[model samples]
Target: MNKNIDNFVPAEEPSKDQPITVLMIEAVGKCNAICGYCPRGQGLLGPETNTYITMDLLDKALDLASSGSNHAIYLHHRGEPFLHPKLDEIIRRVREKGFYTFLSTNLISATPDKVKKVLTAGINQIEMHYSAGLTRLPHEVLLKRIHEIRKLNWELRNFGCRLEMNFSLFGETREIIMEELSRHTYYDETLYVRWFEPHDWPSLEKIIDRGVDYRDCHWYKHKACAILSNGDIVICCLDQFSHSCRTNIKDIDRIDWESLADRRMCQGCTQHVEMNWLEEDAIDMPLWLTRKQEIDTWTA
Candidate 1:
């Protein structure tokens, strides 16, 4: 990870006085799906503890976040948020506190009733992840599920809920996934195509048959900070497993995003790599110029 920081320029320092704009809470530490690359699925985090974030902790985190500025709260990190029993209540409470809420799920447990409950609870945005390479569910079945949620979103237009689909590109499903993206009409405006990142315990050769080397990326620190289920505030979501990179959430306000160690960790993340490229403007080529139009058309 340290080797990757060589070419990376640290992101501009954030103002110490400014409030955090994004906060990710690991609402739960367990997930229902056993994806090949995730820490939970690979047994790196051990058997499901069935842990859920208590309302008290949620309130404290919200208070800390609210003290600064208008922020967005991501209700997940490593776990299946829907499994949290109090998911609806969590969403409603977060909304009541005036923070925008986002949840990402595998959509395996997203029944019609469950979907309605969350939308009514005021989830500003929900993202569903689908990976043909890892998911046991059939492709057509997942596509149907996507359509169901989109129809539900249309019906609840008054709430202005947004939906997004993320497809993790892999060797076995690359062509089919692209075909689905190009041919299918998504109800939401953006479809995220992600390259699988390599992790420990999940044999790299098996997980990433082909993908970019993200060792030198450094963009996460500028975006958000993650609060793990154990209440440790890590530099970013990708560094959850590294204890050396964490501090208690109580110390969040004192930590610096541009610290040398944090920068090194960010330099090794794939999400940071993707975000960096998305923000870069080349001399002979302008990327952001077409990013919006391309996304709009793809979503449309």
Candidate 2:
């Protein structure tokens, strides 16, 4: 029984009538924090990695993506995107191409001047990942940073942009997190609580014990492409974690989508299974509860 899962063939590509709605660009691969649940923080990624995307390559990616119809461009993947010196320029370029721009950060680098620059750059949305479970900052410190960011947003008249806080829920801290969420109210702002995925993290056992499953994930079915900082392209953002799924951005035009669908990695990923389940109304519970249930067994 040669049951090595990695050797499984890819599945057939489904029909894709719509243009890519999301284009995720990895602007940088370096970060200031070492969260317990992140692969980068665990030192799984090498130090020699290209820390930032080059301007020339960014231009090419933007040109290629803009040539088609893209709804939004997310300028992050696995690192502190603010570390990129030309982040403002990147956002401005995306806006010039007539696509909404989004960036997620820990807010450690969100100085008042930098916040002003980001707003002036016309970024359409910003997500602040301020979870105590995922960062070194204490809960109170993170909340203070969030307040400061909200203050900055208010000072800029809300910048006509969307601001969101992404909190990763843990069993031990869930109640406290809920209380914190209740205490904070921002006009027109959104809040999200996400399950912490223990990808290559030391806390895999703890997270798995808390009822997380990684099987039959269908996020690849979504119409989106990820461009890594080094100009490599992957069908899914999680695919970047596995080298087997990566293809050069230049070869994107020649990629065989059907074959890509059949990759063993794609077949085994459960990254966005909850989103897929939600699409089908198969899981009737609230989004958070639906995700909390183990993926091996869940139905509408």
Candidate 3:
């Protein structure tokens, strides 16, 4: 597992005077799938709607983590990181810094051989959100790939690594959802089903019906955070619309860690932070802003 630090981002002062437990980085900014439920429309934001956090900026983030943080870094958000040219390098750098790293893929591009390569590269976890039903791939091919990853004991159990599945909540038929969930039973791995939106028509019920725990993965648990390619940090990946900033590792050190956590853009999942002063204000914020009769209006 290449340990060369040639592309390593230098470490800096801890963001909050100490090392944080978890640092979720959106190294790859978009996705390969055009799932109907994708909240952040692909190709609409940056770089074909898939912007990447450059190697230089990532090195800056590594330099910023204090000696105290043993946090695991997740390479996801916005896009498919496996498609990044320097993905292997990014993984190498993070592991070299002694950080437990995770790369969540859509499982569409993941081949068993590719999975083995990443496993050997010191990835602490390899998670996938299988979009078989939502993608254009034929059902047989998609199922085969899912089975392939599920059988990868070499990457999961043998390496003491974690493998998780993220089932995106879309307007899929009930039969499809059940079929996808059942695939987990066929594999020797764990699964995590995440909802696209709460009020998206009995989604909570579907999760409940599946007997899947409804703990909000990114929001409710407060277990998730996003660092943009430019180093902009936000509370939860989904809360980007509320109060996201274009920050860097240096910028993280400049702000009050706790104060920064006081997200003013959108109130994160209710199960996490109690409705605070900032969240309340955000809730009252305008739904739209009018700039010109034709192009300035913003809609939720």
Candidate 4:
């Protein structure tokens, strides 16, 4: 008798009538850092094996832009996005189509000059990933770079943009870091902490019953569509949806969402370690206790 549990699949809903607003564009194939937990981390899959989505692929995504309410594009999907030389050109093209755009940069190689360039090119928001206060500089020299960029003259602020920090917590003193952040007074800036969940080993039972709330942050699940460089459209980034959740753009006008969602493309997909899936009221214990246990489980 086969006793292996099948993959976790979310409840299906009605098909979408319009295009999802947010689209994740993977612009580059290489990264400057070598984090241990990254998909392109220092293991079987490194920068050598990574491939980037080209301008032609992005053109297709623009053609398929959601004709819905407000269309927003998020750069930096798979690897570090700064590696793309034509990043500014890409942004210009997106804006030319009259769509709002944002970029999630790791801030490793992002210099003040590059920051200014993107801001000038018209970036509405920048979602920066910071590992830790100052100690995690090995992940990338972002902490130092961010400090310098924030101090730019008032002219830089006029680009009309907001900066948000997103940190990945593995094993750290949350209170201490939070206090440090408070002391810095990021000037009412938002700080988001993402819990680490390994893709190779997903906690199914725990995640479903007492884990983080994956549904909350998942805007893509509700509407957005992700276009890979190969012209394959993915529903979400985590599910490894090479099977059915993805559809090739041979005929963009004739996409059949009914059959795509029903396919086993994302059968056993669950949230990642850095992604918090539980809401405050949904968990049994306080936020700290639950988050601590999540870290412990990953560490163990």
Candidate 5:
């Protein structure tokens, strides 16, 4: 989550003792974009009402994770994360709690004020998610927001939050967009771009399949944890829209930290080939997907 990315070893290198490096808290569960390949595009998100995860709930999750190795929280999953008005405040609190934080947003809804506050809010990293070289807004408008963010060189370094771009080759002709976006630099730091194929992400069935080769499992190698906006704690980012969660944040006592890395559930995700489940996090609709829900049924 944070740029400090600690000890991500090869799958064979780490013993079972590898630390759970990141914790995902979906503070906001709504997105401004409706990318067709995403769960939201397929109409499969959690409840629309009361979608913001309040500070109290967040603290509970943090309290549960207090004893873990590398206490970093990836701010959210599958939504325009900045939709929450108190995003800066949330990041500040997480930092105060002795945890690291990062955000991945579409930046379609970003404004100059929001950008400045978020950059200065003690967040360690921020990433812009662009699919087919565009967010929900026109490329021109998206460029304007990028301009807004890039101009904050001082805030970025002062607060420790640097920027990066994640381009999904899901759209037709994403090359031009990637080339255009990569041309810009942020705070003397190159806007590192991570490219992944949405089609390459394995289906839930394949991801859960025990037969998928262990070598293709870079995604689950470095363990991570996740808590939904509504307070439920799932195994990892792959369960973003799935209800097969271990427990809710309120029920922190039931957490099984050691069992997180034993994620046969995440075996096949490709993590952008490694399926870096850390940066990517998703879902649809106003209601949460049930444990019995089948996302495979809703496809392009």
Candidate 6:
């Protein structure tokens, strides 16, 4: 809100000769709740302890993405962006560099105070995750929970942040389900809904099994990349294990994040060459939000 956070034109499409890079900086290394889909829950990914991206590493991330003509920076990947102590700093810095910035959270921890702090911190768009079954709460309880969360939608609207609720998975009954769910949050006009596709899950097995040649993927063609919480640059968001990671952002010299296509981790990788690679239209949110690390501790 302090700078030009509104009236952003969609970035010009990059040519085949030169592709624009959309960077996803994994702000936090830990999550509160464990869902079945994420590799973090399956014990395949995530750090042994809670870790966060440092300010020094964040500057390096901006420099890497700003090397291109026009780009965006998403302050999330597997963990909640709010988990990072410097989340506001991260979003504010990305906005300062004129990148379309975003944040995603389950909103389980999004209290009024925390919501106001983040919405005023220069975020252009924000997405919240919604999945009823994962919470293990009764239907009525879940409804009440969403009702409380949606109350803060007014604040989000006040700051002009595009707020969308992402359903965890796609299903035949999505139309009817979303319609019924929409009734709870009908108070705000800024709210939009998106059906999260199945493949959006952070599973190394599924990606490896169905993956075709790595060259055909959007990450290879469009230069879409992710820097893990530890500053290691991987091929894409799904590379949570850093299997395809080559260079760390601390020593970032070259912009070619996909320079190591021949890595064994890329064998039979995903063929997803589309906008989902460059910009996540629908960001997936975690099931649980409130953790031991409170938002007040995340000071500048």
Best by TM-score: 6
> Going through the candidates in order, what is the number of backbone clashes in each?
0, 7, 16, 15, 16, 1
Model 5 lDDT tens row, 1-300: 112213322234344575554367787877777666666645565455237888888777777666555446778675667899889888887877776577888887678888877666666667888662264566566666766777773434432345677767765456675666556542222546677656422255333444554445433454455777778655556565543454455754645553343344444554435454433421111122222123212111
The alpha-carbon lDDT assigned to residue 159 of candidate 5 equals 23
- Alpha carbon deviation, residue 118, candidate 5 (Å): 1.4
lDDT of 6 by residue, 102-173 (tens): 777765555556666665665656676756234433334444544554555444434245566677664547
Summarize candidate 2's per-residue lDDT along 133-201 as a digit string, tens digits.
246665555666666666766666343555677665534576765666566443223445554434433
lDDT of 5 at 278: 38
Q: Looking at candidate 3, what is the lDDT of residue 257?
A: 44
RMSD of 2: 9.7
**By the lDDT metric, which is better: model 4 or model 6?**
6
Return the clash pairs for model 6, or none.
Answer: 218-273
Alpha-carbon TM-score of each model against the true structure: 0.68, 0.71, 0.62, 0.66, 0.71, 0.72
| Model 4: per-residue Cα lDDT over 35-149, one tens digit each | 5545444443433435666787777777666453344566665566666777777777776776656677777767787776666666656767675223235422455566655
- 4 in model 4: Cα distance from truth in Å? 20
lDDT of 3 by residue, 63-108 (tens): 6543323345677765677777777678878878766567778776
Give all candidates' CA lDDT scores. Answer: 0.58, 0.58, 0.50, 0.51, 0.59, 0.57
Candidates 5 and 6, the one with greater lDDT:
5
